[model samples]
Target: MIWKTIKVNFHRLGSPPTFYRLAEVLAPWLWGGFAVCAAIGLYQALYVVPPDYQQSDSFRILYIHVPSAWQAMAGYVVMTILAVIALVWRIRTVEIMAMAGAPIGAAFTFICLATGSLWGRPMWGTWWAWDARLTSMLVLLFIYLGIMGLYAAFEDRRKGARVACILILVGIVNIPIIHFSVEWWTTLHQGATIRLFSGESTLHESMMPPLVWMTIAVKLMFGAALLDRARNDLLDQDRRKGWVQSRLGETA
Candidate 1:
């Protein structure tokens, strides 16, 4: 009985009205989590963590750069998965989720590019390189842009979403390329410091905490932003419906 009730609630949560209400309840908490995590993470990253013996103070940018890069890739994976659900189930809310996630993904990708350039300039002595990892990341950025552009081209957003969903699935090929490029080919970019298997992270204990915190912060920010955007999309879509009219009437 308990399991059945939970399953029922989960299904209802996928509906637009239920999701809109849930977003309203959850957005503030998620945003607050982002703020708190970001604050602690930045403090630890900027002041608590010791400077890299190799790169010196410049390496501090890793706090921002790594998290942004991680989220940039992670965001695409999430959108692609949601896109698949949207396509298979014909769930409009899930479709909105995919659309809402694209801009945030693109923003993080741009940050990754900019911060990577900054990191590279002093370390690699060049702002840009054709290194496999760097090139693949750049390609990832273009794919994100392509998704947004393709979505905007169609007169009907529903059709646009269907088209973009296909693109997302096709573009997922790039995620692995971005991740494994360093291993696959000769590259100037250093290998992963935080290995999931085998030995623990290469980072010192003090450094690892801040990086973890920042990663959590970015994820919370993504969730909060995604929910807010999805909620707005729902309201826009249902603007003429009675529930939305009543909600607006109450607010007015």
Candidate 2:
């Protein structure tokens, strides 16, 4: 029964028309959520939340840096998972999802690195350092770049998707290592104490809620961007199909 349901759902997913319509409906909600959440999160972080006793005013970087880093890590994992599904089941929709994730993930990764540098200058007495955590994140950024390059450079998308899919699988090994590197190895980057309701979280009440809200805002932004890109992608791939012609005709 479960397998039958999976099979049927996948059949619908194989249809570009269905996936395009689904993405169309979702794009608005995703962008709307991002805008609303971001407004609240920023107000809380920038105005309501007090500065850290230790770091003072510079701690404001956390509102941007922490959330971007978290999303960078999250977007990669999501891409890797979609890549794996694309490879295993040959799902066209999954491939599109992986493609949708590349640029957005790369954007977040760059934000993490840039904001980390800004924060590091004041806190760590340097603009940059190649510590284990820093090094791993840099590598992740390059991985995202490679995935985008792989797809764009090819004449045949199927072959390109295969190459990028392989890279995504290879890079996933870095995620766990990146998370634990601060703990397992001697590194300048600090270890995570708070991770989405983890036991180690000790952040104060005022700070915690805003941090979470910021994270949601980033996730929503990613979703909206992904849906927009995915819709364009599906359209490009299915341009010759009848539904697309009908869709265009209806709009006309």
- Top lDDT prediction, candidate number: 1
Query: Local distance difference test, per candidate?
Result: 0.92, 0.88
Candidate 2 on 1-252: residue-level lDDT in tens?
A: 999998897689767788888889999999999999999999988888888899877887788888888899899988988898889988887788898899999999999999999889888999889899999999999999999999989988777887798899998998998888898889888878586565767667767878889989998998899889988987887788999999999999
Candidate 1's displacement at residue 64, Å, is 0.5
- Write the residue-wise lDDT of candidate 1 on 1-252 in tens digits: 999999999899787888899999999999999999999999999888888899889999989999999999999999999999999988888998898999899999899989999989999999999999989998888998999999889988888988899999999999999998988998999988888787888877778988899999999999999999989978987899988998899999
Q: Count the backbone clashes (under 3 Å) in each candidate.
A: 0, 0
* Model 2 per-residue lDDT at 129: 92
Consecutive 10-residue window with the lowest summed lDDT within model 2: 193-202
Q: What is the TM-score of each candidate against the true structure?
A: 0.96, 0.93
Runs in model 2 deviating more than 4 A are: 1-10, 195-198
Candidate 1 lDDT trough over 10 residues, lowest sum: 198-207
Error of 1 at 168 (Å): 0.6
Model 2 lDDT, residue 205, Cα: 74
